[model samples]
Target chain A: MDGWLVDLVAKYNYWIYVVLMMIGFYAMIRKNNLVKKLIGMNIFQTAIILFFISTGAKKGGRIPIVDYEQALAGAVQAADIVNPLPHVLMLTAIVVSVSVTGVALATMLKIYKEYGSIDEDQILERVKNHEP
Target chain B: MNHNLPILVLTFPLLAAFAVNLLGKISKKHVAPWTLASLVLSSVASFFVLIDVLENGTFKYTVGGWLPPYGIELVLDPLSALMLVLVSWVALIATFSALPSIKKEMPGREHLFFSLYLILICGMMGLVITGDAFNLYVLLEITSITTYGLIAMGRGRAPLSSFNYIIMGTVGACFYLLGVGYLYLITGTLNMGDIARLLPPLYESPTVATAFCFLMVGLWIKMAFFPLHGWLPNAYTHAPAGASVLIAPLMTKVTVYLMIRIIFSVFSPQYAFLIHGRVQTLIVWAAVIAIVAASLIALSQRDLVKMLTYVVIAEVAYMVGGVWLGNTNGLTGAVFHIVNDALMTLCFFLVSSAILYRFGSTHFKDLHQLFRKMPITLCVLVVGALSVVGVPPTCGFFSKWYLLLGGIEAGHYGFVGALIFSSLVNAVIFFRVLEIAFSSAGEESVPAEISGSRETHPLMIPSLVVVAIALVVIGINAGSFLSQVIRVAVPSL
Candidate 1:
């Protein structure tokens, strides 16, 4: 029980990310609605960003920003601070996520305008029928 | 003197994309000329950079004066320089050929159209040269967003196709991001060169292997290599002539270049290929299946533009197979095919747009008497078609020869067979189009037949003619191109 608990604690965050990622992937591949697919895409991107953030996290570590005196005194070791690189990377990913969602929404509007519906099957049906 | 050419090649299009937008809001008529002039300028810039890369070898430019491992850097290697020239040249040709269709289809959206077009070019340029993994992802999104915008502006089901593309493209990009996240977790660096240097020790780790899988799978989806190509045909078929002409030629080819970059540059070939014989064989077989299946499906398409998209799928398979051949010949052929495929696809799309412009129809049936009506256009189409069918002294033939040689050298006879089968399939598709267009002369004097005036814009045919001649020129001069550029490029890889 102790070993199991330690293993779970050590790897639980990645497991959570994997679960979220699978859910997103399922919705993206299997959902019938266009908006649901977009949501899945967002969830998918967010899960990845979360995974990166989690990687950068360190227990009992301070923020990446360090005090000048602490640094000058050689009191602050690099490992004592959370790695800031993944956090910075996730910031860019977040921006990309937002932009992608925005473009997707705009395209969904156009799709809705053309088909009068966003349901995947109905849109495919109408498109097959060559309906205006 | 030429140290700035790398940044300049990328910035020219980005600045012009914005400039065209702002400048057009003030004066709509000036937009087209300005866009063309800037393309010319960028093409000149690209040529200069390619020359610089050749003379100076691969050089890295530090963005904003921040050195590598800490900040974004752009590396101008032989592969990126070749792609730089190809993208700018195709964009230049496509822009000129696009005038007729853009005027006919979107009318008032010309500014938006050209701006997004330039943004796509800029994004692809940035994608090819950037050395940082995260920066490549950002540039990829920029390219995808602009591509979605440009694709959505087409008529009919285009918006829906664009929506589908957005979902798939985003998922592909996200998968790539996940791979980067994994890499960052293990290596704590985002610079590709830095990560590469730090990766050899971790090559045996499951984390690194999984990350490689994620990266390749993401890129495979993006390139639409067979099974994942559901979004491509509808998007290309329903697209307005101009957009299809540009997007069809460049998008998949750019993604293939990205795959090569990831394999040779980021992961390093020794680790990517030499470490795993089974994995290489598996990918090579998958590519062979993609080639044969996509070609057969392409042969069944009635719409010319849509058929070409499937052909693009097959071409993607060819490159993927060639690259995975795990030998110098295979890799070099794959790289050389990149340029050859781009130019030929552009020529094909250009001719299709000219025909579409003349007939205002996308159906193969509407091409009746096309040979008699537009002899010049028909001739150009014949050249493009023959090249695609791998007729000798046409550009596609040389690439296929190299690919076949590579396949045999790698002992992947299945891949060689698939290449030959697809070439036969190309013959069927193009020759069928030729028969449909030429077999029946206009017995009833159709209005479009024998116009002799060329209803398509005059500028469009010149572009088509140039591309057609270029196909032959490139094929004939493949020796020089291979020896000077690709040979040097592959050895460095």
Candidate 2:
């Protein structure tokens, strides 16, 4: 039963990542609304963040802090070792992703001001006739 | 000089960007000089790095004195260093040349333009050097955001184009992050070298396959590969002429570099070849479609800049198809073309912008008699156009020779056919424009009142002269240049 649950959780995690990614991609592709596209972009980036953070977690590993350096001076155990590299990397990725999203939103705002609409199709149609 | 030149390639422009943003309001003259100086500094730094890499060997730098796999790492292999030098050289030339043009096009936004320009250079430098997967993401964002800002700063319809670029660039970056996340899940590492080592045993895992697919999709979008290139022509056309000159040469090429890195540095070629066979085939077909579709599309465009933008779409496929051929020759051809195509693109865009500055015209109809009025610039354009069409005695010809050699070597005759078709289409497309340029009435009379009023801005002329010299130098010395720089870089892949 425990093995089955472990398999199920692993399967569930992969499924969730795929589903969220597909939905984000679908929204990005199908939605004519620019703001909605940005929202989709955010959702897409956040799902990846969740995927990375989840990967760093172990079955029963404690928080990644190894407070007792002296206790492990004589001998180290595998159970106490935690993978913190991915966590740190994920932190940086999250920051970068959010900043790009912020910039994209700002660009969308500017687009709205110029075209008076945020719909992609409408903007394209108008831009065709609007000579610079 | 310290063998730590990679830092300067990125740092000098970045610091100047910050300083310019801070000082632009205080002194209007400061921005151009400061941006020029920093780009020159970056160019010299990259040149030194390339020389060292050629004479000695690849050098690695770890940020904060942390070793690889633990802290961030920067690598200076020959290919990347060559690309770095190429990027900075064109950027410096373009910025100096575009200054006067910027004065005319973007009157109040000079400071913002220069700052974003530096940020763009820094982002490309960072992307080229960093060996950490996550760090690449950060730098990619830095480049993407700056690019959006640079494009948004253009005149009419610029903001709309920038918005489209933002939407596409965001999706690309997000897909990359998702790919990285999947790799992290299976391997528990973000360092590319470490991931590469760990991935061999996990080759059959669906997680690994998914990661690879996600990565390829993300890079394709970033590189503006065909069918996925919806945002590019508008972005290139609508951006400031200076921005177009700087970006049209480098951005997509760097994304191609990243694609090479991920395929070879993060996954062994053997596993990739075996497990991703169908994906490679898909990319090759996509390249064919891009070449055909983009060329046909370019033929119909009346606007010169937009037409050139579509031509870039086709050029990108030439490299993409060459790379996807999956032979050593193909990879080498693709890699060689990256440099050749970049130089050619820079040359073309420089001449195009010069014409734009002179006549306030990029439409084919208004550009009648352009060849007669802009003699020197037209000569440069002819040379660049011939190079773009892959004529003999230019860098473009040799690269296409290799790409064709690669196609034949790999038994991909269809790709060979596509290459020939594309080249013919390229020749026809540009020569058709050339005919328009030369055959039009030789009316040198620019309405003396208008000519007297504009004065053509003093700085703009010298900028063209500098880029013209560079185009000739790159075209002439491509053989030795490739051997010295790109050859060393390809092995790391």
- Give the winner by DockQ: 1
Per candidate, the number of residue pairs that clash is: 0, 0
| DockQ-based CAPRI category assigned to the predicted complex of candidate 1 | high
lDDT of 2 by residue, B311-409 (tens): 888989989898778887788888988888887888778877777777676777766666777677777778777777887767788788889998898
**What is candidate 1's lDDT per residue for B282-314, written digit by digit as tens?**
999999999999999998887778788889899
**Deviation in angstroms for A54 in model 1?**
0.7
Candidate 1 residues A11-122, lDDT tens each?
9988888889889989999999999998888888888888888888888988899989989999999889998888888888888889888888988888898889999999
**Each model's interface RMSD (Å)?**
0.9, 1.7
> What local lDDT score does residue B290 receive in model 1, on the 0 to 100 scale?
96
lDDT of 2 at A6: 90
- Determine the iRMS, in angstroms, of model 1: 0.9
